[model samples]
Target: MNKVTKQNALRAHSWAGVFLSVLLFLVCLSGTIAVFHFEFERWEQPHIQEMESVTPATIEKAMDTFLTQNPQESHHLFVVFPTSDIPRLVVENDHSAYFADQEGNLIEKESVSFTEMLVDLHLYLNLPHSWGMILVSALGAILCTLIITGIVAHKRISRDAFKFRRGGNGQQSQIDLHNRFGLWASPFHMVIAITGVYFGLAMVVMAVVAQVNYGGDRQAVMDQIFTPDPILAPQVGKPEIGKAFAQMQTLAPEKTPLFLTVHEVGAPEQFIEIYAKAPNRMIYAESYRFDTQGNYVGVAGYEFGEWGKQLAWSVYRLHFGDFAGMTSKWLYFVLGIMMTMLCVSGMEIWLSKKGHPVLATRLWYSVVWGSVSALALTAITDMFYSGSLTVVFWCLMVVNTALTVAMKGLSKSVWLMISGISVLGLLVFYLIVHTTASVTIASLQLNIPMAVYVCWSLYRANTLLKRERMAPSAKAQSGSPAQQTPA
Candidate 1:
């Protein structure tokens, strides 16, 4: 591109990043944490019975017992089988859920408010699903635009790949970090952007395609894209859950059953669908269908299916880095953190370029760090309060931001100190509430890392405080404007 073209691309990139900064940051932060949604869910109910496996008969008994207890909840039913990730059998309907013990007895009602809130923030921003999803997907498209323009704008991106200039006006360091992270993570960014858009926009895209090729028959489009629903005659009390489970074992022995859904529950036409995860494959799952009588129907074709269908099915795992067990999850978590930092540094670059206006800088800092503190505070709130946690989180976020701004922007160290304390408070409160029952692998998985972060944050904040305390004295001893540090 020409110099003028490059300059225009730079402007476009900057404007796009500025527009999406806060929402994008929240999305990235929540998504990074949401990689362990299953773990968090398990941690929330540590006292529940967790078994490695449950028989088909046991699952059937549990379902039957659930139906007998709550006859009104017959719209639809589901059984989420235990997996290596979450070894707890979950049976739920539209409104309520319960855990099944080894003996096929319903134990406690499932509750994972904090995990649900975290995942919802990432998925729908706590808005109604339909509109929230579309907005988030649109942001994904804009991220693609920013990615392309960013690459075009940096004419010497390759040459400056490893360059790092510190101890300057701070702009250079921010710019360098932004460029470095963007460059290093470009491939991952592009993959995430494309997959992210697919979730919400897929329906719209399918609709348009149906309009053009199938005379706007949306069902035809769905049938073409996905496996068609099985037609069945009405006449049923309950689906043959055990029979379908056995059929699944015989049919796809290689794939592991993740969950089973009973469609049109208690109706004559009700059928069972089991989603089984294929080993060493990325498609979300290969589904097997059966009629209410336990008669085999057909497969969903995500595995060994059309390339397009397989690609579409694989989006969730690919985007969230859910493959390869904990290794991939950790990788995604670290890269997600880097992506979140990229958003922050991009805004910092804009602020630096604008001469670091005090109000703007303070507001941005309040938003960035205040968000971290808010999440910690909200998690603490969840331990004692059982009300609307989504409301609590956002309210805390606003309160944190307003408090910071009212104080005319506390120093970075102060924010860090607050965040560290909030996190420590959350952990301490959790320990107090659960006491000895809180000690579990799932709980420790999250708590240990949180405890480590508290230590790191406090240590870093103290070091920064010391540096800030000494800076004025050092400048006074020199007694020169040139000796003063750049903002």
Candidate 2:
């Protein structure tokens, strides 16, 4: 392209990047940590021993035992049977629940874990359901814009695509890292962006469609997609969960029951929906329903329905990287980190152009390093504490944010040095503490990769700090007012 065209493209890219970079970085960083939420949940309740399999009889006994303890709440009891990932029977009364061993003894009360809180924060910023998701979806759209403009800005796309210069001028170094990560992670970024948007926009889309096509009754749209027509109301009577469990086993021998949902418990229209894992499918788990009397109803439609319903049902599994197991999770995690880097680097690039303010650099340091530090602290906290993970997480977040705001405009080198040292120290401490926990082999397997990534990030940050300290004039030459101005 000619000089004028190139300049125009750069101008557009710069404007887009400035507008959306911070939001994009937050979304990407949160998403990366959220990948291991289930693992974190397991780590939080280390006392809950793993079991090879939890039988229907075992679950029934647990349910009966739980009912005996809370007789009045038995009608509302719901049990989530343990899976390979989490190996304890989890039983709940309306507002509270506890994990139990295979023999039905209570282990731990229902308390949110730090990692799960991070996932919630990442997806919805811990906002109330209504507004939080709307904000998240808006961020997703901004991410799309960043991706589009980033591609446009790189003029010699193919030649510099895979290049990563180890030692170069500062701008060249930034550009190389940017191009390398952005190109290698392009497909992964696209998948995450689309899926993220889908999640954020799903409610909005449903609302619009409901308003336009279903006269604003969103439940009608949802029912058409998710629920099956009610079979003729059965005679009102006491329901037997045991019989329903037995009948489900027979109807779906190949599938395993995930959970059972009892609707309108005491009424004649009350029915049980048993969500079961598809025996040999990568899609979402299927549902099999039965009446209160335990008579088989019919299969839910999404598992055997039209294209749109199937596609919609599959989004959670697809977006969350839970569909294909370990390989998919790792791929998602790595890509998530790259996306996070894209966000961080995008912000840095903008700041670099307009003069890297000390405050801006410090904020970046706190966000990038503080995130890693928070995660490490959270994992360590889970290994010991029994209170509320959510409380601990918010406390850590508040402390980190406060520290960042306070430290802003200080020496960038000092902030980087301190953050780097803290991250490295935390990683070592976590590894030592974590080794003493009664972690299952499965949990360890998942955590090992995460540990490696954390160490590498720490090392990288430390190395960057060391180099920055050795070159005082480099900061001055970069034209940042904070570096050039006299005290």
TM-score of each: 0.95, 0.85
Tens digit of per-residue lDDT, candidate 1, span 2-94: 999999999999998998899998888898899999888988877777888789899999988887777774568999999988999988888
lDDT scores of the candidates, listed in order? 0.87, 0.70
Model 1 lDDT at residue 373: 86
TM-score (C-alpha) between model 2 and the true structure: 0.85
Give the poorly placed runs of model 2, Cα more than 4 Å off.
1-13, 71-76, 232-238, 378-395, 401-436, 450-454, 473-487
Candidate 1: C-alpha lDDT = 0.87
Top-lDDT candidate index = 1
Q: lDDT tens digits, residues 1-487, model 2?
A: 6667667766776777667665566667777867767776776555466776676666677766766666663345577866665656777767677777777776667665666668877888767767887788777776666676667667788898777766654766887888778877777677777777888788788899999999999998888777655775664765566677777657888876777776666666777777887855655888877777777888886677887788887877777787666678888887887788777776787788768876667776676666566656765676578776667766876787687777543344444444445545554655576555635664466456655655565566567667767678775677787556586
